[model samples]
Target: MAGQACLFCEIVKGERSAHVVMDAPDAVAFLDARPLFKGHTLLVPRDHYETLTDLPGEFLGPFFEHAQRLAGAMESVLGAAGSFVAMNNRVSQSVPHLHVHVVPRNRKDGLRGFFWPRQKYESDEEAADYAARLSGGLT
Candidate 1:
C-alpha cells in the first residue's frame, strides 16, 4: 500500500531526493545513501507494495529485470567480482515499500554473512560519478 507519507513513495513522487541511477516506467534504481558498498543500489517499484507478498504477480518479472540490470552494472561499472541481490519481505525491510538491494561484492570485500558495515561516499561529486558510470553500464 502506498501513502503520501511513505518514504519510498515520496521518492517516487519526487517529493524527496534519492541518488537515482536508473529509471523505468514501473520501477527505479538508486544508490543507497547509506551504502553497504560504493555502488550499492536499491531498486523499488514506482507503486508502493510494503512487502514481496503484497507485490502484484504481473510486476514481478519486470521488477526483477531491473534488479538484474542493476546487479550486472554493479560488476561492470564498479569492478565488483559479483553482486549480492536480496530483498526482505517484512522482516528486515527498512522501508515500507518493496525494494531490492543490489550490493557490489569482491573477493575480499569484508562483508560477512549478515554483517553489513555501512559506508559513505567520499563526496556528492564522487557519488554522482558512480551514478554516471552505472548509467553508462546500463547502456
Candidate 2:
C-alpha cells in the first residue's frame, strides 16, 4: 500500500532529502533532523507500512538488521556508551510511517532525566563528523 504524503514515504521516493546512513533493498536508515543526541538516526522500510503490524515478516527482518548495524556505527562514530532503539505507534506516533529511532547515548550526556532532553551542539563540525563517520561505515 502507498503511504499518504508521509515524510518517510517522500524520503523513500526521493521526494525529500535526508542524510542517509544506510540503505538496503527493503530498509533505509538516515540521520534525524531533530536529533535527541549527537548521532540520532531513523530506520524505516521503503514500502509503506504505517505501523509494526503492517510490516511483512520479510521486510521487518531486514529493517531490524539494518537498524542494528546503524547502532553499531553510531557507537563507533560517537563514542556512545550505548544506544536506544524505539518506535511509537498510533497514539504515540508523531509520524504515520513505521520507523524506528536509533539514539546514541553517553553516560554524561544529561539524558538520564525522565524526559529525554536534547543538548545544544557547539558547532556543525561535530554534527558533520558524527554523520560522516557513521555513513562511512554504511558503505
All candidates: TM-score: 0.95, 0.85
Residues 1-139, model 2: lDDT tens digits: 3435689878877789776777667877777777888679889898878899998877767678888888887677667888988898877788888989999887787777457776545666666666678988752
Candidate 2, pairs of clashing residues: none
Residue 41 CA displacement from its true place in model 2, Å: 0.2
Model 2: residue 22 alpha-carbon error in angstroms: 1.2
Best by lDDT: 1
Q: Candidate 1, after superposition: displacement of residue 23 in Å?
A: 1.0
Q: Write the per-residue lDDT of candidate 1 for residues 1-139, one digit (tens) a residue.
A: 4224888888888889878898789998888999999989899999878889988999999889999888899888888999999998888878878999999999888999898899999999989898889988984
RMSD to native, candidate 1: 1.3
- What C-alpha lDDT, on a 0 to 100 scale, does residue 15 get in candidate 2? 89
